[model samples]
Target: MGRFEGKVCIVTGGASGIGAKTAEMFVEQGGCVVVTDVNDAAGEKLVGDIGASKAAYLHLDVTDPDACQAGVDLAVEKFGSVDYLLNSAVKMAPGMLKDLSLADWNTMVNIGLTGSFLMTQAVGNWLIENERPGSVVMMSSIGGRQPYGMSGAYSTVKAAVKMLADHFGIEWGGYNIRVNSIVAGHIETPLTAYLKDPEIKRGRSEVTPLGRVGQPVDIANAVLFLFSDEADYVTATALNVDGGITRSVMNHMPGRKWS
Candidate 1:
């Protein structure tokens, strides 16, 4: 049997990037999943590709508390109890703080930090009330480890996401609800594709000790470990899946420009 056989999970931002890849992998591993995103088209297509038997698409705006609950509800209704939550919804508006707008800041804070909290709460509560154990993985960023210019409030929000995971781990461990955060390196995802000018990619690669950047699969593997029983004893921690890039921050994201 596959690792996630007979399990169910909710993947936010599941229409694209790391979220999309992770959802696909979940279904491949025999996990039923509710894949949620505001992009209904992509979300539907993803479920269609994964087949409706093992997956469902949800129109979720993670920043909305009701919408977050709706995703958990959909998972239970479509499959069964949700066994895992991958809070991957986030917005990255690249700009200096001086050039940042209120909208940019709020969007980042709402989607990345607040949204994570909402989803984790919904899942954690359900797991607790149902008397089941589960896991939650929040998608943090290497930016949270070090301040980076021209990344809007990304660093700030991701740092908060880590803290949220830490807090949940402490508060919910007694209930057997494990919580952890993943700090990803420069991943080559659809969301980061625009930042992939050859020079910038090279800079990221050089800074990474692995002499390469990360991919969605890298983060997905880490997330799955956290979700599985193998990590039953691992909780309340931040896992850096950054190719050792965090040993030193990139001097600057070169070739970054204002739109």
Candidate 2:
């Protein structure tokens, strides 16, 4: 049997990019997935592609607590129980701190950080009530640790997501619920589709020790491991699946400034 056989997973932001890829992987591994996203058309398309027997699409606005709760409820109703949750929805508006508007800042934090919290709470409570164990994987970024210029809001919320994982990991460990964050580097997803130019892609790849931009599958594999029983001992940690980009800070600097 596949690794995720008989598992039920809820993937937020499942219409495209990493979320979509991860949902597909889960279904491939025999998991029943609830794909939630605001993009109803894409979400439904994905569910159809995966086959209705293995997947279902739900319209979810992560920023809304009611929607978040409804998504968890749907998963339980459809699949009997939720075994995993992948919080991958995010809203990024690049702007310098001084120029960033208050509305933009709130929007970023509400969707990225607050939305994650709401989803975690909903699933976590269900697991606790049912006396079942579950795993949660939140998508974070290298920007969380190494801030990026013109992305102050995104970076701040990502950093908070790491801490949020830690808090949940500790608070829910006694109940056998694992919580962790994946700190991705420069991944080539729809979220970063703006960097489609060859030069931009090459520049990002060259800076990484691996000499290539990361693919959604790279992050998806990591998520699978974290959710699998193999990682039963791992929790409250940030796994960097960044092609060594985060470690090669000096390589990223122009002309080796310090040296």
Candidate 3:
């Protein structure tokens, strides 16, 4: 049997990028998935592509409490239980803080940070009510632990997401629920279109200790591990799946080589 033959997962932002890949992986491993996203077309397409029997789509804006609960309700309705959640919904507004508009600031914070919080609570509540064990992986960024340039509210929201995971992990541990943050690196997603520039991509790849940037599948693999029974003892943790970029500070120096 596949690793998750009898499991069900809910993936926010499941239309594209890391979320899409994660949803596909879950279904491939024999888990049913509730794929939620504001992108109705893409969401429906994903559900179809993954096979309707194992995947279902919902138009979700994770910032709304009702919407978040609806996602949880959908999972249980379609699949029997809500065994996992990946909070990958995010909309970035990049600009210097001094020039950041209030609308942009709120959008970044609400969708990225509050969205995760609402989904976590909704799913966690359902698990508690049913006396079930579950796992949640919040999508944080490498920027969370350090500065990421020209991302006014994005970095701040990412930082808060990590702490949010930590807080929930502690409060929900007794219920056999695990909450953890996955700090993303320079992933080549639509959100990182700038990486399309060969010069920019090359620069990023060179700096990464692994000598390459990350792909959606790379993150999906780590996420699956966290959601699997293998990680039963893991909680209240932040797993950096960034190709060792965050801790390669010494490699940042010009002409530096740790090889």
Which candidate number has the best lDDT?
3
Distance from true position, residue 122, model 3, in Å?
A: 0.4
Q: Model 2 over residues 46-120: C-alpha lDDT tens digits?
A: 999999999999999999989989998999899888999999998887899999999999999999999999999
Worst 10 residues of 1 by lDDT: 248-257
Candidate 1 has an lDDT of 0.91
What are the lDDT scores of the predictions, listed in order? 0.91, 0.93, 0.94
Q: Write one digit per residue (lDDT tens) for candidate 1, span 1-259.
A: 8999999999999999999989999888889999999999999999999999999999999888999888888888878789999999877877999989999898899888889989899999999999999999999898898887889999999899999999999999889999999999899988888547998888778878888888899999999999999999999999999999787544446786566
> Cα deviation in Å at residue 182, candidate 2?
0.4
State the displacement of the C-alpha of residue 145, model 1, in Å, after optimal TM-score superposition.
0.4
Residue lDDT tens for model 3, 162-232? 99999999999999999999999999998999999999999999999999999999999999999999999
RMSD of each: 5.1, 1.8, 1.3
Q: Which pairs of residues collide in model 3?
A: none
**Weakest lDDT window of 10 consecutive positions for candidate 3:** 250-259
Output the better candidate (2/3) by TM-score: 3
